[model samples]
Target: MAPKLDIETYPGNIINNEFVPTPNTRHSINPATGSPLFKVPVTRAEDLDAAVEAARKAFKSWSTTPFSERAKLLLEYTDAIEANRDELENLLTKEQGKPLSLSHTEMDFALSWLRAFATMKIEDEVLQEDEEKIIYSTHPPIGVCAGIVPWNWPILLGVGKLGPALITGNTFIMKPSPFTPYCDLKLGELAKGIFPPGVVQVLSGDDNLGPWITEHPGIDKVAFTGSIATGKLVAASCAKTLKRCVLELGGNDAAIVCGDVDIDKCLPKITTLSFLNSGQICMLTKRIYIHESIYDEFRNKMVEFTKNNIKTGAGTEEGVVVGPVQNKMQFDKVKDIYAQIEKQNWKTALAGQAEESRNGYFITPAIIDNPPEDSQVVAEEPFGPIVPLLKWTDEDDVIDRANALRTGLGASVWSKDLKRAERMARRLEAGSVWVNSHFDVDPRVPFGGHKESGIGMEWGIEGLKHYTNSRSLWVWKKIFE
Candidate 1:
């Protein structure tokens, strides 16, 4: 059964395990119906100050806890989240409007991370002892850090940042996207009681509050996930104070269907990922380049698959493959792409339309046939369900064309011959490449971007180090008679 979308509203910032309403207030709407879901208090300058100060106060004690002890608490957190999985999933669907099942998957993925980063061998990895002078190294936590996350996969991404920050002993002040703050609040409500006061806090509001937090001198580091342009601003803001930044930004990921692959099976998967979260994802395959020998056949199959599979409607409805665009801005952006495509005389192989009598933010999936490689529609990243496909004559040409785009977060290669696919994957200029799958994230592996896609990497063993600073201690024994 689909879960009820009765969003529970919380007034303001959760600082030091207390909910105190601020001077400002805001409304959270359900994107599926464009109806007001909940009216909640917003963040203010005072709220931001309280959050930073709370984290600052907590850091004095949290930073000294044993890594093993911290690991135990993370495992407890995982258990608690798993026990209330259904409730958590409901909160995600209420404000965010993603399919409930997918929401659960996100939560399940988070549990694995809680344990992975928790049980990590930090003592072995960071602490080294030498008999000569009792030389050792310690991984100290960065002081009060702020984690600013985007709307897409809200809970999961927040957990991704949370797991590492806590395991490495950093107290945090988290701010979720205003578009979907319900789940973020739920996390705060639950965690405030479970963890120590001021150890982890949440602030929900508009973009203004976030900028204020980023520029706050009290914050030692800023970890964000959003657009490349906004990421640039975050990086710049942190630079002035010499504060650390971890930004996971935008990507115009490319998908290549080589000459030797089966067109019938792979085309469906390609169409599925192109509009994931309504193509709001940074790792989505926005650009598609096909081998010319099989280009015509692939395009036809892609059109058929897209038309049949990608259905858009209320996220809580049954049998819906994709949900409504998260809000009005998303809807307008998608419509703008449609209007632009029509004006350019570009061919739309499979076109989807918004339904009448529905007050929802929605759009059908689109499959655009051969467009000029240099055209903005093909070259620029259109973060909508619409995708433009291009054709190249040879394998090398396809590689070159795919790598031409500036953003390089993720790329995909589809082929039956493993060797060819592997070679092609290596040639694509991105942080991650998938041979058969489009977007699959593993906690044990490192995930990040290259070039304009963003900086540094997260996940894996090295990811834990991002929240910590290493200190080397050395002492020489004096030779005395």
Candidate 2:
């Protein structure tokens, strides 16, 4: 069971370094308990205007501040988050419906990312230099960026936008999803004293908030992480202003298991990768393709593991390995896919029922064995605990099937044979490919999807450059002389 929370007292929008009340407020429900968790201000268009103006004002000084000085402030922010790590983690678990342990890991990643960004410096580049002319390029900050974060990993994704935007000298205003807004809003409140008046701000609201932020003339860039449908809307809105945008959208990641691999050693890992965070992560393995020779054995092992080890309940429950779906919307989405599975009469290797007797939105993890290629469980990203296991006879055939989807965010190949794994990994179409592992990301490596998965990159030097624009400088010597 989870501790009862007082959701009424959570902070509202942060503008000009202070928590301000808005014209209206909305309540966010706890996915694990199916109850109201907190009430956040529903930021209207006017509130967005105010937040944008505040960011614009702060950018004047923040953009000009030395990179070293900005780094110091970010480090300070990292320290503050670390100091309050436990409290933040608990809050995240309560609202986000991730296990407390996973919430701690999210905080850990957020801290490491902030620290990494703090130490990085993008120096001016000299494109050409000669006795007669010197040409150099400067990466200047794009002012007043709006970071739209999703609910799955709100704090980490929010910081993913913030680290790059702030380290590169742009002011940021974050719009957290209404599903999970408590921790992010609190983070903004904590950052008030660390950053300048408007360097970092957070606003929470209903669906309207995202459009207002993306379309606002005052915003120079929009960094968004969400579904493909919503990402398209955000892009269209930014297109009107010709504002820069970085979108990390949806992914139906695939994991291929080779016949040559050891099933005993690999089955445990594969199950963990598939169902981690209740399958909410964008990069998690949604589709599993196994070689025909080992498909039956692999399927049996996976079913046994999931049946024995995978348990779903409230996030705060001590022995629960998986928590409830993040919210009712996602829960219903998963249920719809289950309905499709039932309609198709797909072979179910393992399935469990939700604890409707309890108040939380709990659904048992499900594993479907070899659904049709065009089935919704196989073709679409379920983004839930439901996954399909397909058998493939040929490597080339599986590669083609894996890449056939509209989304190409991430994929993995598992085999004990190093050379074989690498060769297959190269052929799969994705931004990130792993051998024998999945969802292992580092702050230093660049992460983004190919095709419809996302546009632009995040978390590396390439990510930092996205928050800035390039300006060329040229000096001609003695042309007249």
Q: Candidate 2 on 1-481: residue-level lDDT in tens?
A: 1222233466668998988898788888888777876668988788888888899999999999999999998988888888778888988999999999899889999999999999878888999998999998989999999899999999999998999899999999988898988988878877886899999999989988888888899999999999999999999999999999999999999999999998989888889878889889899999999999999999999999998888777889886778888888888888888777667898899875644436777778889999889998888998888899999998899999999999999999999899999999999889999999998887778889899988999888888989999899898987999
Best by TM-score: 2
Clashing pairs in 1: none
The segments of candidate 2 whose C-alpha lies over 4 angstroms from its true place after superposition are 1-8, 354-357
Residue-wise lDDT of candidate 1 within 1-481, one digit each (tens)?
A: 2222223657667889898787777887888777887766688888888888888998999888888887887777677677778877877776777777667778888888778888765553324445444566766788888889888788888888888888888998889899888787767766776678888899987878878977899999888898898999999888888888888889888899888888877887888889767777888888888888898888888887776677777767775667777878767867877777778878888876644227777787787888888766787777777888888777777888888877889999988999888988999899989998789888778888888888878887667777878777665455441
Give the number of the best model, judged by lDDT. 2
